[model samples]
Target chain A: MNYPWPDIGTPLDQVATPMPVIDEDRLAANIARAQDYLDSHGKAFRPHIKTHKIAAIAHRQVEAGAIGINCQKVTEAEVFAAAGFDDILITYNILGAAKLARLKALNGRVPKLSVVADSETTVNGLDATFDADRPLTVLVECDTGGRRCGVQTPDAAAALAQRIAAAPGLRFAGLLTYPAAGGAAEVEAFIVGTMALLAEQGIDCPVRSNGGSPDLFSAHLVPSATEHRAGTYVYNDRSMVRAGHCTADDLAMHILATVVSRPAPDRAVLDCGSKALTSDLLGFTDYGAIEGYEGARIVSLSEEHAVVDLGGCAAGFPGIGAMVKVVPNHTCVVTNLFDRMVFHRDGIVTRVETVDARGTVW
Target chain B: MNYPWPDIGTPLDQVATPMPVIDEDRLAANIARAQDYLDSHGKAFRPHIKTHKIAAIAHRQVEAGAIGINCQKVTEAEVFAAAGFDDILITYNILGAAKLARLKALNGRVPKLSVVADSETTVNGLDATFDADRPLTVLVECDTGGRRCGVQTPDAAAALAQRIAAAPGLRFAGLLTYPAAGGAAEVEAFIVGTMALLAEQGIDCPVRSNGGSPDLFSAHLVPSATEHRAGTYVYNDRSMVRAGHCTADDLAMHILATVVSRPAPDRAVLDCGSKALTSDLLGFTDYGAIEGYEGARIVSLSEEHAVVDLGGCAAGFPGIGAMVKVVPNHTCVVTNLFDRMVFHRDGIVTRVETVDARGTVW
Candidate 1:
């Protein structure tokens, strides 16, 4: 498929509809704000690259004093590693022989590569893949009330760490948890307890990673975590705004779309739909929020059309051919949908970057 | 990003996890079934390419006796047209100058290219782009109880048809609609009224296109509709089965994923998540249905992890590293997420096809 990305100097109106755009000023501000906040709290910052999947954005984040980057998949980390990004942490359980072999290769390419494991099956796969010549760093993932991809208790986490320390080809690094929203207290308790248990077993725990965009500002509350990770902070979305983490002004990315059809006085359809703006409701009834159109709800979405209910709005409905900007419900999934994103400053196109790891889901 | 699509003849177990697999036997059977059903009703079958977006499958549909192809976007149509498809109908309102220029070029390439318009603004854009030397065929899009993008009334549809016929560079071909589910009676009434209005104005109405995968087998009920359009029938999904359009055995596409993490006794995480399997619930409580696991539910999804709750299941939970097949709630959105799809017959891989129009949203 051919993507007609606009040139560097093109204006936003002439670029195209149903295209993802990043505001350069807002993106820079977001990266700097998160880095400064984490730095003031004396925590290492590792921005997750799953949000943008662009090496340029990762470079910006690193330049803003991020300690490293966090990836979710082996193939996704391989893209950043090839682009000269070292000190990467993959916050996913690496299981199966095919993925373990690729993880070993990625570890060899980068200066420091680490992964998380919550079970003996995953740790065994990692231990069998690496050797003493180059040991792989493995972090024990604790539940911490997240109830997703983590051990139930701190005892299970410490047990996994002990097994990791005993393996010749693995190092028991520390504890990691992707906690539920507003669960910073539980996360700190889980990590602190696991660290105390590891100390009793004579295991040197180094990294304690905690992550969630919803509770990014509350990282200081979890004082035991040495490093903090976040992805959606770079692109504040409708979900973030609703969570009070960031206001609408801090949103860096917006889907530029055109009003292609207005079937009724109460309804208008945009060119962007599930293919451009994803179906991740993130608890919102609407797909996204349209800028300058308060009370307008994106009620439904087909493959390439978003139906907007214009009733109960103070503002008049946009006529056909008028362009509108939509702040997606979840910006990360929207980033994965497009091949390239147009970066702009003050409505002037700055650059167009290809999503390097757009479809590296495995 | 590098996608390690498996080689031909690779076993299903050898192929990478979190990859979309198409059962070739089921896919062929689906295409033949839809075509034969539509043929038996003496209605033309214009398969929508947005579901699969692969030229190979489109070729298969054409060979199975589809009259033409239906595309939702101009660039999407360009892909099938480049692959030797002559007759194409883009069922979208092609607005804006950038898209209209491309639409004119596409019309010049294909032998029979048509488009739908509901407003005078869209028709004027089309009329201004093309010349009378090579006129463009335009169909009036009627709402017909589907409140997405269409004229609200039959009178409005006939008015647009008259405007198209009066334009020097346009031809009022007929009427088109994407009706609501089980809206055959409403669709027939609307199209019949529009045709009568067009007949009173002495306008020639040759084509009446009615489409919806949920009402695929009921095409004969809408006797006025000359052709039928359905996309998901080619790859039946959970929603299709729930709608009683096809059985679960007719589902062709499945996400072959590996159990990556078994953190708890009653919970397991699959490698496929919102990025691989889409976040589109399609009114289902879970993301997808696990084959052979009757009571297991995919409770939640992250970007790269699907947390499955194995509670109350008659069958045992899948151990870590065990492979499972999942029928997605909606197959069309899943196809848009991946760069390539694997095809197999009887558990042996046959081919891998790149989604040609994967990110051609604009």
Candidate 2:
């Protein structure tokens, strides 16, 4: 609640174990890398705000050449909108009266409000919500490879987009899809195929957008995609390292964790666990990595502590009151868990930003 | 983020859709069942507050005859302290200067601040920060089948407890262990075994606590356990249902989500995913059940949308612009993701409490 406690009283140092420490300089560099990539690609960067879920970072991103911010939920968009982002894109399939109500409310505030929808049923809902007076711009999402959402066939995509246009309150804006890593070719084919289908039906498709940090480098090859969304470039994590996007040293955010117990000679305990780091079951076995702790994998996670299991090879970890910077498996969820994060630049405390939309779980 | 955003400003009917909705009445019943079990067992119910992370709920738990609240982090304990909780037991291996500084700050507020450590390394850290005057309480955490933190042998437990007592500013309280479900015999043996060693060493043992929700129903069989810390009883989840702790209806919390997309004829998508409900990395395949969809499993989850593999059962689902409820595998992690949650009695919404210590990453 009342963070950093006021007591914990003064400041902390490298020895100050167990608090998320963001190396601001590294964060800036991570941000610059994303900017440089987008700049090189000549693509509009509407980074997903859901990743960092920090208004401060979002503002910095906008300043660094992002066209706007894309959020996964209306609540997140609303939080960002309230924090003074004029242009916001909700990169989610909007549905229902509740979602429409929030969208209407948000639409009144922000200058540009764009949303993506996959099905005709969602289009009808949008039609009912927006009517002829305020025509809602709808984008048909295609499930190129990630069989999560969107129509499969190009004909289905065209039909869905035309159906949205046929609705009194909804108009076909373009095509939108979120492809998985190494999905640029697939996304390009889907967009091209869907656009050709729409053109054959005498319907025009303008905006084509697709994005993910791992694929951002290859995004330039997809000429039809005018907009790109990437979230993790600002705070590169261990996954980014594994993905070959960045080196481990390039990561900006690191969980400054405290070692509580070395139960065995090998197992060193840290105060961060699923509760803090989040159990984002991201198809992984670990929550994070304790820097310098070799052969140690975060084997188990309780709500409080991450049980680091070191089989055979053991090192004398930072004794009892030792603090180690842990680079979480994923940085986005970790940032979303906190209300405020203290920034550090060049090993000196810079500033703290309130994660204004830390939790808008609906 | 202002939640419950409708597509067209229509309020949702609480009963219209299926989800893992928490019935306040059911929650009361569940709490009653737990307290009744502890009362029948003559054990103090010091609920592990990690499940709820809400101070109001914790206070309500205390009002319902709880001896105190058992927290796992100094941050969690600080929240309870701020809420005017006098005595709090942090059942965690607290470490580092930053955390100890926080504990020292908490010591000034809460009268009784007890923690557990299984090793001399951990106890020594306690001795370092305790300021000597505060007199922090420590307990030996013995491994009693959970295979997590804790000393492996009772002899080691006694040795650690002695080391804790001998360490300046640390007062050895008793023995603590988190037993695997129905592992009371192991807990009893450890406590008795450790106590005998303590007596042989001219030591006095007072409190002996064993905690874990699944074992609450059968905890008293461990004759040496005086208190129990059970968190999930406050808000049972889908995992608890699968674990035989509660019925599906006994769950006290649900993600209020809107059906944003109908990606396929059979598959419908909801707006809540790993971000809202949390990807708790549960062993189960289903994210949660679609409230009323008989045998419908949410087979896949992305960051935002959960692709419900409807199995050619589209006719059973609600229209596109509809709201639906879904139960998450783990409720505790989901609760930790939010700052405040609106409570409802019947269908009418009521109060909102700041999840006072929702996201304490440290």
Candidate 3:
């Protein structure tokens, strides 16, 4: 459990290469900006902790006026719950007996714990696990445009909500949808239709949740959504910048790496590869972007070496032993790769926080 | 760390979804097969622990006649070393003062420790850290055909080897190359030429190492290489099967996941996603190959959901709550994503071993 992090107040140069570092100043600003933007629209903010997976960062988000936090897995919620956070929403279909047992226990401890279900199987499992005296809140997951999970149509969503409401140990909490990149209009139509159907059935829906980092600022576009959920906004990445959601200046996480080998005039190898960065391309051809090295492309990634083609760069390739900062294509995946992340301000280390929920994918 | 693993003799049906499981019979067979194959060719075998990152598996490889263990990072080697492993070879350029200090400490404890270097910056750091009384063994890494973290030519390797020989606290060991797929001729040529140059310089080349799982059975092609190293052969993956190295039966590792959603007849969603199975496509278009379900493609993966397309399957898609096994594109990266791996025999749980170096990327 000993993380390879330098002491507090240590300079960035003294820290090891291929390590995840967060700019404290930028991190605070990103959290505050997102909360302020959501507050302006009178929308409740529930920042997803999957991006950082650190309890301290989640505390900052809650302190910045977030109503609750979103977790992807049962064990991830347990981490933050142990760290003293109360409100948690797990936006995943909780299946199987084992996970249901854990989820029931987590619900017993947390004040307001909510989960989403898209099918009868998930609803049955949740109903079978909870007791009548303590009903677990359930949200119907609707697939508006994102074709990953959730019910196909608003009618299907209304049916699932009725099923949840009829269950003895489950209470129907409104709707949840992880929309496609620019599918706000579709999300709005689906939620509106589902709500109308529920009205006809005499079911009162309270929470309407919608989220996606690619369309964070435009979350207000979905007028029916009451709360917003987002994970990637905590640490903006190359894909966020490409989506025009956040600029490079708002990027908080950077992989500090050393140029270990210069095998060719146009090629250099970095110590940070797929293990340090991530293989999640997020629609980018290259692995990541070098901060100051414009046009340099990460051609390929071995387990521990990132082969960069410096041919596109107007400036020459970095010499061996030189250090470079790389902005990962997807910062959330990068956060899960490490056990701890170093927080810094103006290139000086402030503290190191353990990624408590890293590898808690189950 | 409390990993979500079931007890001994637990049924596969009882275990949690999105968990990495290894068939104990197949794992033992893989270790024995690779050892016998290398033994028949009169070549020493060094199993890279980066694939499993478990001491029990490393111990099994040693019991199966592996000469030593190979590590990619200093902290990873320290993990195996603490578990009673000696004679470790770290195949990475040891740069920076902090890592060199660690390398020196590891070398002091291990009976025999070696490292690779392709630049003077690495060699100088080693020389500055170690004492002359107990010099560290250094190998010159040649690029051969794998254009990553190595000298481009035999001459440059020879030059680096000579530089290591002259260093105060370093001993030149030999040459090492991680050849490109099917690039045995280039590897042989590079090693032969480098040995000749070292002979002319009166520098003794004791060991020559060459390896890659794709070209594992063709180790004899590089006759100059005294030893061979391979990691993925221990748990053959989809990429290894496509490379004609091992069959589907040789794939020991699998992500046991639950079918959480069946939104469309052609589309089913698995609980496992990029966090369970890696996103390393290698050269495959799909994320992974689903066992028992031919022509099913894992079209996309979110952090917690794997959207599968069963359109091409002759059989209908699996219903919600059904379990499926996934063979990842790259097994090594998959191993890095989990804290513990479940070992089973004939669909019955045997034990769960901790991935000791799970996140020791530093």
Instruction: Pick the lDDT winner.
Output: 1
What is the descending DockQ order?
1, 3, 2
- The CA lDDT at B344 in model 3 is 95
What does TM-score give for chain A of every model?
0.98, 0.93, 0.98
Residue A179, candidate 2: C-alpha displacement in angstroms: 1.1
**Candidate 3: clashing pairs of residues:** none
Model 1 Cα shift for residue B205 (angstroms): 0.4
lDDT of 2: 0.76
Shift in Å, residue B81, candidate 3: 1.7
Residue-wise C-alpha lDDT for candidate 3, range A1-362, written one tens digit per residue = 35468999999988898898999999999999999999999999999999999999999999999999999999999998899899999999998878898889889999999999999989989988987888999999988888878899999999999999999999998999998743888999999999999999999998999998776799889899999999999999999999899999999999999999887888888999898887999899999999999878998998899999988883666788889999999999998898888999999999998889999888
Rank the models by lDDT, top first. Answer: 1, 3, 2
lDDT for each candidate structure: 0.91, 0.76, 0.90
Output candidate 1 Cα RMSD.
1.1
Q: Which scores greater on DockQ, model 2 or model 3?
A: 3
**What's model 1's TM-score?**
0.99
- What is the per-residue lDDT of model 2 for residues B82-147, given as tens digits with 9 covering 90 to 100? 889988998887765557787878887889889888777677778888857778888888888887
Global fold similarity of model 3 (TM-score): 0.98
- Which CAPRI level is candidate 1? high
